[model samples]
Target: MSGYLMSPRQFSALKTGLFLLCLVPLANLVYGLLSDTLGANPIEALTRGLGDWTLRFLLITLAVTPLRRLSGLNWLLKLRRMLGLFTFFYALLHFASYVWLDQFFDWAAIWKDIVKRPFITVGFASLLLLTPLAATSTNAMIKRLGGRRWQLLHRAVYAIGLFAVLHYWWMVKKDITQPAIYAVLLTLLLGLRVYWMLRRAGAR
Candidate 1:
């Protein structure tokens, strides 16, 4: 942990604040559900709400390395594990809402949706990619897999992000503006990594 960012107390407080902020959306969902205030389409609202947070957390997790690189706040990396887990958490809720509320756990219909629907296929693939990352995000798993192999497995996160954006884009048939914005943001993030990679290769 770099001593440059803030005192230990302040750092802990920052994490606490971020943790509560992340929970706000889930809390709002619960409140709306209990009050019957999620408009006429509660299932759609719940699913979309969960997807929004999943994307937000994914982007935030991706931002951590760049943030630490630019700002030199090395401790920022510590937050990535929590943020990554939250990404998977919301993703699980998104899939669960679809299966339980939308399809009523009808395996046939769900399988048809996964196979037939482009958006669902992309979303499901992203979830599958994320599962191993979330499951192995422990010190034990790290030691077992070894750092090099663990990093190779986790690199699928970039592909997950791409699949997620594609899933959203394919889902929204009418308005592409929102999806476009996320795509552009993700492209910029990818571009930054590519730029640094080429620079490093050139240096070598």
Candidate 2:
């Protein structure tokens, strides 16, 4: 294999490792439940934990392109789809926790919360946007959609990321430190992409 690429076996190994690594957060949460270590507000802890992992995976998915460009590691692109799928998986879990555990399947109350709560509104919107992305993540869908259209659809991730940050920020009423950090990191990531676009346009 070239320096910029990985051998097939190595790639398979790395992909498996990453898949398992991504499950660690979920595993830890499960362990906490079994051990009764989630404290007084276990449901809230579980819901927030899944949501945090969802945002983290989303940010990590966004970072793949930058990392690949910076490190000249084209293999990183191979991992991106998997990372994106994981992001959606955790996002689904997060939403499920809220709808089931937190809201107790109360559709009327859920609708009310979504309508009245800014954070819930954005969080729901984020999940709605992620649904199509997750559904069409397959190679077959990409082939059917064609590369250009698929790329356009996937660009919604940027908006999803923005909504996710807003969801986190607005949900926290006190000690906005963590949400503020997420905001700064997301700004830098999106800003880097903007800078690159202008640079390319200037070169052209």
Candidate 3:
């Protein structure tokens, strides 16, 4: 583990690199729109592209702990906050696209869709749940809330992830292949948590 661990300079560089790499997806989306490269349904493409990245980031954030534990790379914990924030960032963009592009700021229709459509409802709820996670992501907030309470609050992420997966699943009613892949990945991530919890309890 020591051999594999990164130096301060190396870690800083890696974090910067990861941060920039994360923005590439949004950059590509912007390029697609500006260059008129996105197909006929550009709005749909943009919205789905943002939503897809949100899910990807969410899964990546959740995997950090397990990866850190397995690989004995404790510095991975430092990256978790950035990854989680990016998850919320993408999710915000996704929700914003749905409200602005898809609904055209038609609050009435948006409200109705949230109420009537299960997928929209789930997606909306996921965003709602993510709001506080993003808000309290700061070190100041962590100190103010206390470590235990902060952990409890952020635990809502598990539900958010499940709802996110369900939202994607229900949205693509016919072709569920992508959603299923996310579901399986999420299941494994969560399964690892459960296994660790049970192992700790047994040790106790």
Q: Compare the candidates by TM-score and give the number of the best one.
A: 2
Q: How do the residues 77-167 of candidate 1 rate in per-residue lDDT, one tens digit apiece?
A: 8889989999999999999999998899999999999999999999999999999999999999999999999999999999999999999
Looking at candidate 1, what is the lDDT of residue 153? 99
Q: How displaced is residue 124 in candidate 1, in Å? A: 0.2
In the predicted model 1, the residue pairs found to clash are none
Error of 3 at 8 (Å): 1.4
| Candidate 2 segments exceeding 4 Å error | 1-3
Model 3 Cα lDDT, one tens digit per residue, 1-204: 352566789999999999999999999999998898999999999999999999999999999999988988888888899999999899999988988998899999999999999999999999999999999999999999999999999999999999999999999959999999999999999999999999999999
The alpha-carbon deviation from the true structure for residue 11 of candidate 3, after best TM-score superposition, in angstroms, is 1.3
In terms of lDDT, model 3 sits at 0.94
What lDDT tens digits, residue by residue, belong to model 2 across residues 3-117?
4466789889999999999999999998997899999999999999999999999999999988877888888998999999999999999989999999999999999999999
Off by over 4 Å in 3: 1-4
lDDT of 3 at 57: 98
Candidate order, TM-score descending = 2, 3, 1
Over 4 Å off, model 1: 1-3
